[model samples]
Target: MFTGIVEELGEIVSVEPHGEAARLAVRGKVVTSDAKHGDSIAVNGVCLTVVDVEDEVFTVDVMRETLNRSSLKSAQAGARVNLERAVRADQRLGGHIVQGHVDGTAALLSREPGELWDDVRFSLPRELNRYVAEKGSIAVDGISLTVTSVDEDSFGVSLIPTTLELTTLGARRQGDLVNLEVDVIAKYVEKLVVTK
Candidate 1:
């Protein structure tokens, strides 16, 4: 579990493939302060277990399934990633519950800067429309943000300065791909309602 609260913006230091699998190494300060081998870390919205830790860099294996489902398929060295350590038992729930399981990926459609913040619009996959709602929570590229509004094809979110400075979202360009995780509660509710 994670809060979508990004601890620090990390860089993909290296990516090496072996047969059908690959190893991903990420380097960051805040997130590696107490990390150990076998720990779980949310890298760009994907929960990966740590297989190795050296200095501030840690590595995880990327299975074929993970690559196919996320923007990580195109991840490369020097790419900026949002990093979050697994939520602890005694920690406060600053953000909504996030499983770090990406439901899908969204494409950035446009961006509009405002005096105090910026509003970003992302294409909403038709299959995920029912699970997203205005004012509801959504995780984009591992950063938890509220849905400012929703439409037939996409949704929008307002980004504060802090969010802009601390996450990869600040650098998102039009047409960029981002990982998306809808509210888990919403998915469960929809399942029950449709089955009735």
Candidate 2:
């Protein structure tokens, strides 16, 4: 598990095909500082195990199912990704419970900039619409953000200057796709209600 708090903005060093899967090497100094083989790290909201660790780079394999369900399918050598280590039991839950399991991808609809913040809109997937709500928490590209508003087909989040400068969402443009993970608590509640 993770807290959806980005520890560093890592760059994809390379991605190579390995039969039906792809091996990805990411360059991140902070996240790889103490990383070891078999350690789990959240990359753009997807939990990936560390297959190898060398210096400031760590490698993980992306299977076909993961590639098809997240934005990683189009990942290139120069793409920037949000990186976070798995949360420790002793650490405080600063953001929220994030399983690093992406529900789906959302397209960047638009960005309305302000002097100190920006309201970014994204096209919410129809199947996941009911799981989102105004003022609820949503993980976008692994960064935890609060929903400023929600409509039938889209949702908006306010990003402060810190977020714009520290994470991948800052550079996202119109029509770009991003990985999204809805609040797991909401899904559990729904399941319990239906079963009851």
Candidate 3:
């Protein structure tokens, strides 16, 4: 339910552990400006519901499943995370549809920099190789990007200056872990074809 366009780079305020969950507080200006209890927000590619709201800060309860599937487990105070609110009906679809449901995490294999751009290669789960395609859409850390190329074991995406400055990807280095969500449409198509 998000466009994958980052609204703001929010910082983690705190991470507190509960029985089988963790409570995360984030400080964001744009996303929290109109956020209320029960609103959905994407933090580092994971969609979480708002349980509490204060000025420039909102709290969300991260269940065990979310922690296991996404990058939130390693999240700490002051960590810069990409934030995006649910897409509105009248707004333009600037980025592809991102459900905030991360399929798995990928490791940054390498980064090649250019004068004003960069290409980052990532090693994804081998099982997901079937879903990724060249020129297809992929969501990394809640930012929508196109697959510049795909190989048997990995993929690469070119990041422009705007993407570098607006999201957490700018801070990533080799061996860094990032949450990834593949195109939902591709998954559905594959499912139908397999059932035939």
Candidate 4:
């Protein structure tokens, strides 16, 4: 599990394609500080296992299912990815609970810069709309952000300067694809209500 707090902005060093799967070598220093083989790393909201680690670079296999579910299908060597290590048992929860399981992908619709922040809008998948609410937390490209507003088809998030300079959201352009993981608690509540 993760807290949806991005630790470092990493770069995809290389991508080697195999049949129905691909191997990605990502370069991240901070997240790899104590990482070893089989450790989990959240890359753009997708939980990937470390297959090999060498010199601040780690390799993970991206399966066909992962590629199909998230924005990783378009990931290439030069892509910038938000990276976060798994949350420890005794650590504080700086962000909401995130399973690194992306519910779906969203497209950047527009961005409006404010005096102290930027209000960015993204298209919301219809199936995921019920889980998103105004003032609710959502993980966008692995960075936890609060929803400023939400419509039937889209939602907006206020990005502070720190977020603008730290994560992939800072460099995201209009129409770019981003991985989205909604709050896990909301989903669980919905499931329990249905079963009750």
What local distance difference test score does each model get? 0.93, 0.95, 0.94, 0.94
lDDT per residue for candidate 4 within 74-176, as digits (tens), equals 8899888999999999999998899999889999999999998999999999999999999999999888899999999999999999999999888899999
* Model 2 C-alpha lDDT per residue in residues 49-131, reported as the tens digit of each score: 99999989999999998998899998899899999999989999989899989999999999999989999999999999999
Q: What are the runs in model 1 whose C-alpha is more than 4 Å off?
A: none
How does model 2 fare in lDDT? 0.95
Candidate ranking (lDDT, best to worst): 2, 4, 3, 1
How many Å off is the CA of 137 in candidate 3?
0.4
Regions of model 3 farther than 4 Å from truth: none
Once model 3 is optimally superposed onto the true structure by TM-score, how far is the C-alpha of residue 92 displaced, in angstroms? 0.8
- Score candidate 1 by lDDT: 0.93
Candidate 1 per-residue lDDT over residues 30-85, each given as its tens digit: 88899998898999899999988888999999998888788988999999999999
List the RMSD of every prediction in angstroms. Answer: 1.0, 0.7, 0.8, 0.7
Q: Which whole-number lDDT from 0 to 100 does residue 74 have in model 3?
A: 88
In model 1, what are the clashing residue pairs, if there are any?
Answer: none
Better of 1 and 3 by lDDT: 3
Give the local distance difference test score of model 4. 0.94
Candidate 3, residues 1-196, lDDT tens digits: the string is: 9988999999999999997789999999999999999999999989999999897999999999999998898889999999999998899999999999999999999999999999999997888998899999999999999999999889999999999998999989999999999999999999999999
- Tell me the lDDT of model 2 at 92: 93
Instruction: Name the regions of candidate 2 deviating beyond 4 angstroms.
Output: none
